[model samples]
Target: MQFAQFDVAAFLNAHWQKRPLLIRNPWKAWANPLEPDELAGLACEEGVESRLITSGGKQGGGKLALERGPFAEERFGTLGKEPWTLLVQAVDHYVPDVAALIEPFRFVPDWRIDDVMVSYANDGGGVGPHFDQYDVFLIQGLGRRRWRVGPVCDAQTPLIPHEDLRLIEDFEATGDWVLEPGDILYVPPGFAHDGVAVGDDCMTYSVGFRAPSRAELAEAWTAHQVDAMAEDDRYGDPDLSLQAHPGEITAEALDRLHGMVLASLADRDAFARWFGHYNSLSKYAETDWRPEEQMEAEEVAAMLGEGHGLHRNPAHRFAFIAAGEGVLFFVDGVCRECRGEAAQLARDLCAGNEWSGSPSEEALALLAALINQGSLGFEEED
Candidate 1:
């Protein structure tokens, strides 16, 4: 699913995060890759995050109604036919077809990607008018959905308080449109918007991005620095002048105490490496994605000799940053040092869906290690 007709530069310049933009049928021919039944089946699986939002006279008219799931098999059947939606998070981690939908959008840096969330709805159904703190591309996958965009919202904006959801209290639509299959709506962070199914069997594939807030970065990185500190790394002003007034702490002591924390914060190199490892952590990090039989160095060498290429797990996140004569490559939050051919191989693996090249023995060693960890897989090409 290549975006042959879309203009990447123009979109970035005019609208990347500036405002909302509507791209009508960007793909050559938009064939929806997942079925409603298939999506429903995914919702019923345990450990998969999912939710059902319902509204109408029978249940309740959009005031506050939501159900978290791994739902029962019969749950979908009981939702009636109107005003209900099922949303499944991180669908790309489980469905290859859904994962492929992310390929065209890789123009957005791979590291910044969060995950793909797919939602299905009956007529007149919506989660409600609300604004997200992260940017998202709402891609219409199955049927028509009437979408309305409102003014930009901020932290001071009022929200309808509910135990389960944060919905906009008063929404004033400034733009409205109906999206058919293949159409896409790009909304930036803090932009209020709502989408409702105009007809039955409406499906939307949302490719969301991560945006770390300032407070979050401060807290997380501070914690990382704190954990790295030595037990004896406490503030000490050894030049203790005889205190004229012991009850009042000296100004010099306060400055020395503050400098202790500032010293750690000033280490930009350490922060960079820590952030790279932190952000590369995958959503499926806790779950084992490794192979049952680990590959040995000899096996990997033989496979590469046989012209088999390496394929990364769709659930795995791979990235690299340039270091001295080599690059520090990351897989599922862990870093590996690779130089020369191995460094290039790391770049290649992260750039494309498949990796193939005449390998160095050193590169093969790293590949063998990755294969054993289940971060990458080797298979024969048909």
Candidate 2:
């Protein structure tokens, strides 16, 4: 499906941090990745996470049922019988088709791309009026849902029925619409909205945006930088003089300390590389297996020279190969060039797929070495 040619850059620059705008049928003849039956089956799986919430009384008052990860289908049976909704988070990473549905939106920064959450609802199923802290694009995939949204005026406004759900108290609808399959709704952070399923079954895909607070960024980056710093560089006073200003941290000293931390992340290439690696790492659990034995270098060289393809493990996010004078690695949000043949093999591994044919001899050799080192293993592709 071709997406609507909206000026995304302009919209992001203008309304991204400002207001909300709904775009109708953003994609042509939009199709859902998974069928209802497939979704139901997935909900029943032991490893798949699922939840059901029930609401009663009115549009604003409802009871919520909060469940954690790895839910089985039997758990949801007989629950949320009426006036309730079922929401499943991180559906994209599990379902390739759903992941593809969100790929077109990569025009937005990857860091801002959160998981695709699918919500299934029965007749009268609706989560009470509420506002989200992050921007989200709601696409109606099946059946119909009624949505109402209002502008946010305060950040500290108390919301949520329990510690888990954040429901708004007084939500004045600035807009009201019934979403049919293929219809889209864009709600910015703090816009209050309520959606009710109008029929027996309804599904909505929420493409959420990530809004990392300043504190969050600082915390993550600081830890990363500290780990990369050299040992024996701890803070200390070399010229100790007896003075009465023991509690005072001088501005110059504070500035120096800040510089030291910032210096670790100051290199543009380093920062990008780490961010890319961090972003690509899988958040889901990986299957376990033992590594394969190492192979001969000559055999590997022959295979690589034969143009054999190399592939990465679906569950492995970061892969590095030693190149000449440096190591080639992909991390955080960027890629880095490393020295030696190992780096070359790593690059080859990062680029290959099952369809790309067999791994080159050189790549095989390197993989064998990594396997021998217990750094990698072979897991059947899902």
Candidate 3:
């Protein structure tokens, strides 16, 4: 997909996370990558996460309904019947075409490009007026939907609470537009918007951004660091006096804890590895597969020689091979260590796209290992 010719870098530098900017026909002739039935089927699966929203009236001021993750098949029985909607998150991880549509936006940091969520709405369906903490670009796909968005001014503002959805209480729309297929609307954080499908079959793709809260980052990083520490020598408190004094847990001890935290983060390589692995992991449920048993090296080499394709597992964002010494191995987006021929082989595999011609002995071995570990495999073209 050719990106809209706007200076993405400049736009991002200027308005990203600051204000919303809409670009019309960003992807000319943009197609709906997944059909409504495919999406609904995926939502019904136990591994997939999904949500449903129903609104009461045309003005969108009515009873709200919500349901969350791992939805049951029976829940989708009335999908095409009335004023309701279903949203399936992280479609790109499973659908290659959908994932490829997002590659153009890789200019934005991987950490910021959260996931692609597809929403299918029936006539007069909406989730109510609400503001997101992160930025998003809503791409119109199947049909038309009217949207109204307003700026968020206060944190303590009241909201209309449904069973599982939080909607703004007194959202005043500053902008309104009808989105047709291929049209795009950018909404920055704190923009209260409500989208109601005008037609019976409307599908929209929401490319969401990640806004990690300070508390969330601290919790994730601290847990990772603590786990790493467990593999090493334990934190020692040599001065053990049985006397229980609340004041005795002095500022110095607190400082020591802080120091340990900083020390863990100080290893730049370790931190980068963690961040890369964390972001690359897929957010959606993936299909499980078992590799063919006892495949010979010659058979693997022959398959690679015949130009078999390799796709990175949706469940696995990164793969790494350990290299001795100071060398690090990075495949897809994951990091590890490698040396000599192994390092070269890893690079070729991670270089993106399909591999032509025969795979080297080392490459074949690596691919075999990846397949065995349920991380990657060869796909035969029909």
Candidate 4:
């Protein structure tokens, strides 16, 4: 489940977000985690993000086609055998073995990690040549896949006229390779790349990272700050003076207006707290991850007394930020201010450590709350 031999520092400094690097069977003992049939079953489940891409169109011998799922179980059998691929997003959220793959790549910060998207493709099957805005490490899990790496692309790059797929008009490969099981290829953001199965039953796991655009951050931050702002908190001109020209706005007025906006947005501490919650928000926010029955403090204490371990839910996000003597622990969009033993517990939880040692009463309460909300669960429950 971990890397056999690799230089993390060197890779980050020389290749990360700079260029593509091909790693040959880096795992100590590489084993395919999810079966093709298992992945297909996930595609047929509700609330699972999935896509079916057909090269010769859905009906066959036409333009490329894209179909969103939860698809009918019979649909897979009917798709003409013209090279199609089934991609299920956030496979790690559903598969524990698949989620363990992310642990090896923890050199990258937790928040930057998006999720592991697993795709199963037949011979000559691929989603087409396209560039992603975020970085991704493509891990070949089953069968061989021929990957064509092209130059970096941007908004100006020309695309083929396909309604669903944003395929490059004429992709030129700078490097090419056929990856076997356990092999990995890291593709930086905005780089054009294409992968097609060399033979049948090819499966690839894509561990993609989140690279929020400037506009996205600005918009989200603005929305958050606005929601907290009061209507009464408006621009004021206590020291108003008559302007020489009534039609012209004075420099003094402009400065005050600009300062008002900047002052409201320049709270680094407030932004840090807001971002901790924002970043910890689950990718699948619409899907409820709460436990079937609300966990009680008595139950949590009984389990802890029995020497049961606590673990995080892979589907939920967990992060913490130091605040004075305590920490702000954010989980699934909820933030809890932890002090003393609770603070230490938060650190341990984020570090993926199991419950150990005696915990304070406050710590037990926090644990119960987390378990009740489905952010943390007993190791046996997993």
Candidate 5:
């Protein structure tokens, strides 16, 4: 569904990350996507990450409850009438309906987009008051859920220590409202909030965006660079000036070393390529995305000749960035260089789920590789 009526620029300027905003029933006709039974089925799958939280203690909000899932069907029946919630992450990767929820919000850059996490809750059910390190758009799907948003929280904010979950120690709601179907709440990073199902069949789709910490960037990027660095590519000074104190490293030597380090990290080209691969890494990295049999270049050409296009796997993460004279295209953690028509193909794949244009030979090769990797599929496969 296209958000042709929504003001994208106004929302970004006013509430992207600055604060929270409530958009009441923005869609013309908002249809609930996944049913609770489907969500429960997904939770039972071993490969899918899920959680079951049965709130206990005072008002059913305490540290005494929570369980990881791959649970048996009987477990749902055993939960009883107690307040509980089921949360499944990256639902978009598995369900096309859930993935469609991300399309409307494409006003934001594609690289910034994460995944859709769907949750089902019973009356009085909640994950407890807490803050996230990433921005999220909470869209009510099935039933009513009363949400409470408090003051902004940060690193200093105290959390109730638990093995599975980190909940706020104490929270006071500054604003409370019940969200009906199609309503949306935009919560920026580090804001405290809680949501409880007003009744049964309550479902919420959380479209989240991540903010990589400085420490994370340093560790991951440095690790990538270290592996790629040559052994002889070490600190070298061709002309070293003598110093009065031999114990003290000369400023010139230190300057050369620092310059080398800066030069390595500040290589925009290398960083661009690295980031394309880095950000394209799927949340389900261990889950293989390869097709059973790789399609040949001839088959691809024939398909394109027959007016068939390319489609991206819902489970794959695809993106591209303009790098110097060419483009760096990334799909499911693999990076490829693109030029000419191939570059346009990369951009098209990133922007849309399907591609219909005639493929150049170079584009055919890249598409074949992605198809073999199981991230790109022929339109006829649909």
Candidate 6:
């Protein structure tokens, strides 16, 4: 599933986050990974995030309609002839082949990589003209789609009034293309674009990247720091001196107060550790990924001894950072300090490769814990 012909470094320099680029059939062999029926089936399952959008049909009565799912299995058959699209979020988490699509895009940082959202649109169907706050690579999976790219948009841009959809009020395309299977369109943040199905059975896999807003970072990071603060760690002025106006706060006092706040927040080491856990959090926090049966350390070691490798769970995120003589390994919202063979194992696991390291007792214990917690699993032999 690797790209047949493409320059990763060139794409990043020229087009990534700068503008749009359309790539035609870049894969070694382009094959539709999931069928249209299979996608519809996923939309009907409970706990799966999905949506059905309709326009100019009985469902919406000429206006755009948005319905959240897990929809009834029979609902697909009831939709009358109308432009409509079905969107399922994080499809790669549930589908293995779909998860494989992310491998080629690993040129991007793993932390910036978000889940793949797959959309199935009928003829003339689309979600309408809109812009996303994050970068996305839209891979045409089945059939053809007409995609139009427009100028960059921002918060100042006006939108057509709709309850759920944030469609642009007026769209003027600067670029247009009809993409077939295996074609990819890279859309950067703030760029307005629209895609409409040219015919039936049109599916597109959108591989999105995470772009944390400043406000969001400030809020989350501050909250995390606050939780660790002691109650007695309040502002103090032991060096206070007599002032002309007792009520007036002096510039020196302001500097001290501001410095206190800034100094606390400026702990890069603490922030890095916090972000490792924050970024590695499971997308579906409520969905438990723990395995049914916990494996013993001896059993896990034996399996590794027998040449079985471990694979990371697609639903969970893994990352690490150097800390002193070891690495702080973060996975599924939990962090552990790994040293020696355990450190090597953490690096290997985060690489998303089959774990094939020489197993030590410490490493085996870590592996058993990960397997039990559902962050890693035994790779199946072919």
| C-alpha root-mean-square deviation, each candidate | 1.8, 5.6, 4.4, 1.6, 2.2, 1.6
lDDT of 5 by residue, 293-368 (tens): 8888888889888988777887888888877777888998888888888888888888898887668888888888
Q: Identify the superior model by lDDT, candidate 1 or candidate 5.
A: 1
Better candidate number, 1 or 6, judged by TM-score: 6
Tens-place lDDT per residue, model 6, 1-382, is 7999999999999999999999999999988888889999999998899999988676546678899999998999988678999999999888988999999999998989999999999899999999999999999999999999999999999999998999999999999999999999999999999999999999999999999999999999999998998889889999888899988989999999999999889999999999999999999998988888999999997887888878888999988998988999999889999999899889888886456666889998999999999988888768
Please, what are the lDDT tens digits per residue for candidate 4 over residues 255-319? 99999888889999999999999999999999887789998787888888888888788889889
Cα lDDT of model 1 by residue, 162-242, tens digit: 899889999999989999999999999999999999989899999999888899889999999988889998777688879
For residues 1-382, write the lDDT of model 3, one tens digit per residue.
6565657888879877777666677774577788998888888877677888865554656577777757766777755444888898888767876776666666665546677889998888877788888888898888999999888645787886555877888888888899888888888888789999998789998988887788876787778878867566545668745656766776667777778768876876676676666655555425454365746668777776676777655445543434344335543344656556656666655545344455567666766766665566677566
**Which residue window of length 10 is worst by lDDT in model 5?**
55-64
TM-score of each: 0.95, 0.72, 0.81, 0.97, 0.93, 0.96
lDDT of 2 at 84: 68
lDDT of 3 at 283: 55
lDDT by candidate, in order shown: 0.88, 0.67, 0.72, 0.91, 0.87, 0.92
lDDT rank, highest first? Answer: 6, 4, 1, 5, 3, 2
Give the number of the best model, judged by lDDT.
6
In terms of lDDT, the poorest run of 10 residues in model 3 is: 318-327
Residue 37 in candidate 3 has what lDDT?
87
Residue-pair clashes per prediction, in order, are: 0, 33, 4, 0, 0, 0
The true-structure Cα RMSD of candidate 1 reads: 1.8
Cα lDDT tens digits for candidate 2, 60-155: 455665556455657557654556677777777467577666656667655467778898888888777888778888889999998988768466
